[model samples]
Target: QGLRRAAKVQAGQKVLVIGAGGGVGTFAVQLAKAFGADVTGVCSTKKTDLVRSIGADDVIDYTREDFADRPRRYDLILDIAGGRSLSHLRRALDPRGTLVIVGSERGGRWAQGVDRALRAAMLSPFVSQKLRMLVSTENEEDLQLLGKLIEGGKITPVVDRTFSLSEVPEAIEYLRGGHACGKVVITE
Candidate 1:
């Protein structure tokens, strides 16, 4: 819902989800589809099938080609696995599109994507496109809404692996290695 709310997604819109095979990405794709948008998922070659199976109308393999270089332009772009710069992302976004930066895996110790988000906010007023960052809010209403969506089969959580209490370290290592297909759960 964060992606949908941030992007103000409307039916029949063109939506692109970066890092569409990961935990958040998977949900984003499904939610976009539920909103009746034409959804495109971006991921590496190995995860393309997973993204496609989850309801992405189109799947772009980042390793093989950059979506920004393509002829397509999205009405809404959700940058969940942020590695691209604002300019790079803008290239793929429609002139009046909205870009929502959700998270970034790359950055210095001080701040990850926070810096980029700030810059986007500062620059938004000067540009035709809208660029903003998403800070998720937890509330009972939203939780219940998501629950309904899950119950209705509009969204499903993807758990790639689960580790017991003793295997926490190994689980962290696996996450750091970036090999997990989806969410990694730690069980007590």
Candidate 2:
């Protein structure tokens, strides 16, 4: 919904997915391709191949290269990593593009990473680009659509690791470690 509804992604548009190897990033890369957008993914060195294999037209290794330094600009940028500043992200976005900040893990306890989103809202009107934050809500219509996509083989989930129900604490720790290449599941 963030890609289609918020960013208004169109076919043939250049899309960039930051943190393109993690849970939401993995899905974003595939979904962007499914939407017929030319997708570029930014991830660590180890996840480049995974990102590419998942249908990213270009994969940037953030460890070795800065995507903002490149000449390429994106029509839509999905920032899931939540590490960079709005100014830094805008450098890679087109003048009239949309920047959708999905989620953030860094912020003070008061705002809990929502400060960036709030700042984006405050700065949006003054800027040419559409700087917005996504607040997604689940609905049966969207869920059914996603189910169809999954059933039709348009989207494939990547599960990096699975732990038993008893190991929930360890699973949480592993996710907190930020080393998961994809979703970490806790199963019975």
Q: RMSDs, each prediction?
A: 1.5, 1.1
Counted clashes in each candidate structure: 0, 0
Best by lDDT: 2
Put down candidate 1 lDDT per residue, 1-188, tens digits, no spaces: 55557778999999999989888898889989988999999998888988888899999999999999999999999998877889999999999999998865566455764888878888999999999888888778878877898999998888999999999999999988775777999999
| lDDT score at residue 56, model 1, on the 0-100 scale | 94
TM-score of each: 0.94, 0.97
Q: Residue by residue across 1-188, what tens digits does model 2's lDDT show?
A: 88988998899999999999999999999999998999999999999999999999999999999999999999999999887889999999999999999976665566887888889888999999999999999889878977888999999999999999999999999999887998999999
| lDDT on C-alpha atoms for all candidate structures | 0.87, 0.92
Model 1: CA > 4 A from native? 109-112
